[model samples]
Target chain A: DAGVTQSPTHLIKTRGQQVTLRCSPISGHKSVSWYQQVLGQGPQFIFQYYEKEERGRGNFPDRFSARQFPNYSSELNVNALLLGDSALYLCASSSDSSGNTIYFGEGSWLTVV
Target chain B: AQSVTQPDIHITVSEGASLELRCNYSYGATPYLFWYVQSPGQGLQLLLKYFSGDTLVQGIKGFEAEFKRSQSSFNLRKPSVHWSDAAEYFCAVYAPWGGYNKLIFGAGTRLAVHP
Candidate 1:
């Protein structure tokens, strides 16, 4: 089966602009989570959705939002993007919100200039 | 707050040599620990996880980890390192909040293998 897949593998955005990254969870997976990885840093949790409901959110600002669809796909949106927001946005999928078997996608690289 | 720490920022090893990456975690209760490896420009891949059971857990790609409750550490080890094993290794803990859970990851250790 295919693993979690993300779109727009790489993109460039201007400051104060908005960007959206999409993710398709693996078949039969019900949970999708978002993470951000700065250069030379590990991935940090941003948000998680299960069954089309927000389950958990990290320390990100209100400018960042995410939603899951009926098919278990997800989209992460960032408004008023800042230069600091440039990073690799990763999407992970698990069997459930509480399962320990999470898998990550290749991630979408966003560069804010 | 729950957190993970990887003491070594980078490590260099020769092929066919044994390798060890140190990881320390702080949590209120028993922690669900995991080790993930990421190649350049790629995503994270689960190497192994320790929830509850034997302290020593074997993972894919000739990797293994030992969880020490006393030291609050879960270190990844490989008996014989290969050139392809060079990547960033991360130590993470599953943090459960209410009915949901998320992973808290360490800064990660970059491994370089010499021929």
Candidate 2:
């Protein structure tokens, strides 16, 4: 089975612009989480969705949001992009029943200028 | 909120030499610990995990970790390092609270292997 997949592998945006990164969970998985990995740092949690419901959120600001579809696919949105937002956005998939082992995607690289 | 700490930011070792990467996690509950590796331009891959076991767990790619509950550490080890082992290693703790599943990761330790 294919692992978690993410789209728009690379993109560039300017201040005040908005960007959306997409993710598809592994087959039969119903939970999806988003994380941001700044250069030289570990990934920071952003949002988590389970079964199309918002389950948990990280310390990120209100400009960041996410949602999960019925098919377990997910989208992460960042508004009013800032230079600090430039980082690799990662998506991970897992199942609540299958233990908490998460599988991460290649990540979407976003650059803000 | 849970947290992880990796004391070493980077470590260099010669090929065929033993390798040990330190990881310490902090959580109130019984922690679900994990080790992940990320190569350049690649995604995170799970090396191993520890929930409740004999403290010694084996993972993929010739890696192993021993969970010391007393020390709150889960240090990863490789008997003999290979050149291909150069990568960033992360220690993570799964927060089993609020019916939410998420991992709190450490800052990560970058490994450089000498050929």
Query: How far out, in Å, is residue A10 in model 1?
Result: 0.5
lDDT of 2 by residue, B1-115 (tens): 5779999999999999999999988888678898999998888999999989689999999999999988989999999999999999999998765666678899999999988
Recovery fraction of native interface contacts for candidate 1: 0.80
**Candidate 2 versus the native: TM-score?**
0.97
What lDDT would candidate 1 get against the real structure? Answer: 0.95
Candidate achieving the largest DockQ? 1
**TM-score against truth, every candidate:** 0.98, 0.97
lDDT of each: 0.95, 0.91
How would you encode candidate 2's per-residue C-alpha lDDT over A1-113 as one tens digit per residue?
89999999999999999999999999999999999999999999888888898888888999999998989999999999999999999999987623478889999999999
Candidate 2, which segments miss by more than 4 Å at Cα? Answer: A97-99, B97-99
Report the error of model 1 at residue A51, Å.
Answer: 0.7
Please give the lDDT score at residue A53 for candidate 2.
88
